[model samples]
Target: MRAVAIAAAAAAAKARRISGRLHATSSVRQYSIMISPHLKNITLTHSDSSIYSDDRSRPYGQPLAVPWSANQIRFAKARGSDVRPGNVIERKGKVYQVVKAQHSTQGRGGAIIQVELRDVDSGNKVNERFRTDEIVEKVFVEAKSFTYLYTDEESDSVVLMEPNTFVQLDVPKHLFGDSLAYLKDDITVSVELFNDRAMSASVPKRVTCTVVEAQVPMKGMGATPHTKKVLLDNGITVQVPPHVITGDKLLIDTTDNSYISRA
Candidate 1:
């Protein structure tokens, strides 16, 4: 009887991991204490409800956040290692993707290397941060260019056209957030696609736009100058200096939508 129960428990654990439905739960511990010899190397399978006895209490579909710290990641030395997609390895207790590797450098750094990385669970790309001597694992991230189409009045959504293709994808307005302010008709945006759908999009790091409105200059604002709210042509409002007036062109940083300088 005990052996049978242990076998069942081991089977449950394997099932939970595979389904990705099993979250950390104490009820899972009821069967976790048992280990069956045959189930030692068993692979997890989806639809295994026996994995977590606490399923009734815990939320379903919550992803486990794996943390990877900066100190733990060391650069991989070889460009052609087994850094393939969907391989999870631990570096400094944090996990990162082996997105893509390329060799190139501007005139200054000689032929240095670059590796794009993505946080596996959060699905965010960490900026290129490894040195040329460092070898890192690869996680596949799909990239494609899409042309801005138009937004829907009812759904408050926008559309993008895939390059070289007639297919259009409907993207929610909230996903673009402030970035949408700068988008013009037919503007091209770099999109990161995962599992055949768009996950993230980015625009140029810097862009210049004409200010639609600026507040009046303040009295005795001091030599440093006081900044006030200014609306741009795209309808996004940013803080600008007191001297800034309507129809003034200014360069802005797209990274945070902060004002840089007059265009």
Candidate 2:
């Protein structure tokens, strides 16, 4: 999210903590491909399985390191118009994850795709505009399941663990933003990775949270269905129907922190 850009800058500074080791694998077949012919000198190659090449002498270019231990990595392509949040794309010799994408029309000029991108390496953010139909290198990554351990406020990172191996990872706390309140101890979280980079973290859309406080409704508080602001168990405030009250467990949309239904 655009709001998480501030947190991304701080998270990318630390060398991530890891618990498991992955061994290198044998060589695989590789080929060269480019969407545009103007930049044919770039020698980045994509193998059926591996994305990087061991050799760097070729005129084409050095490929990215292959994730040998994990078989969930995937490769794909998308136009700038189709780009959305969390899509990892490479541009100008750097890889970035899309944080926000907006489309606008400029009278007779054409459609412009405006995007906010966060660097995969440094978490630095940049705004760029692209023409519609421009081919973009999109890498579809798979998520690794981890158990929510705790939020390490001192380090500004959230700690997670592998359910099977118990290996722990400390991710940037800002990555979760306000949604951090929905996290509970030992909950399953999906972390997406690209070339060992933590692209994003997400929780289930709906989470059961108890209303900690709310005012009783009187007359028509709202022109339509009356609503009231209530505090949640995790210290997040949300607007809910007057029927909701203290001690009521209601489903909340973690994506936007909105009230869903009584749980």
Candidate 3:
């Protein structure tokens, strides 16, 4: 009987030890499950940091380059004949847009390229001659939509705003030159921006303006290509057909400043 009691006691002690071991294992598993979500959150935070690290240093929502400027190409000046109209070139730290390019070879000199260029910032026209071996830096500019707000009489500048964001900017009047005659309140124009500054503004190809003053047409002049001088509401003078009269709204081509038709 004594041996059986001792055997029973040993069996009971073994059972208690086994139960304690199982309880410890279950506690460890519960701890692991509880910590898994925190670990996952930490990993996600690291991933987000890596993804947006570059963006944090740039302007908000601003791209590295203009979207429409992707096709812009740069050409090194190798020959005078290589320069073409509509090319923008940089010289003496000033930018100029080429309006016309003509290559000519003098009787005694090397080939010379004559280029008529318009100053990008001042809208002034200049004539330049370049040698075939001279180096020129070609630049490309991109245009954006801007709304005409008003002309600042004090500064002789035009005020414009972005169409979508309404960001306002003031551009020099000379940048528009005679094109300013076509500008009206609330008119939208294509503005070329360079270095975050307005370089040029282009009016629509055609615009309607009221004829504020028109001279009486000469009857005998009908046999010839005769046009009467008329003053527009914008104070610009243009030639119009004989039939047009005062208060007549006429369509005008902004490119050549020629009359198109009656509007």
TM-score of 1: 0.44
Candidate 1 lDDT over residue span 65-103, tens digit each: 323322232333344334443333334555554557566
Question: What are the clashing pairs of model 3?
Answer: none
* Cα lDDT, all candidates: 0.61, 0.72, 0.72
Model 2 off-target regions past 4 Å? 1-77, 120-124, 218-225
Worst 10 residues of 3 by lDDT: 41-50
What is the alpha-carbon lDDT of model 1 when measured against the actual structure?
Answer: 0.61
Which is the winner by TM-score between candidate 1 and candidate 2?
2
Q: How well is each residue in 1-263 modelled by candidate 3, as lDDT tens digits?
A: 99868855755564444334432312222111111232221111111221223344433223222122343454345455778876677888888878899989998898899999888767789999998777788765668989999999999899999989989989888878688988899888887776677767778888999999999755775474567799999988998887888999999998888899999
Off by over 4 Å in 1: 1-139, 218-226
lDDT of 2 by residue, 117-187 (tens): 98766668899998888888888776898999998889878899989999898877656656777889877
> TM-score of model 3 relative to the true fold?
0.66
- In order of listing, the candidates' clash counts read 13, 2, 0
Worst 10 residues of 2 by lDDT: 14-23
- TM-scores for candidates 1 onward, in order: 0.44, 0.65, 0.66
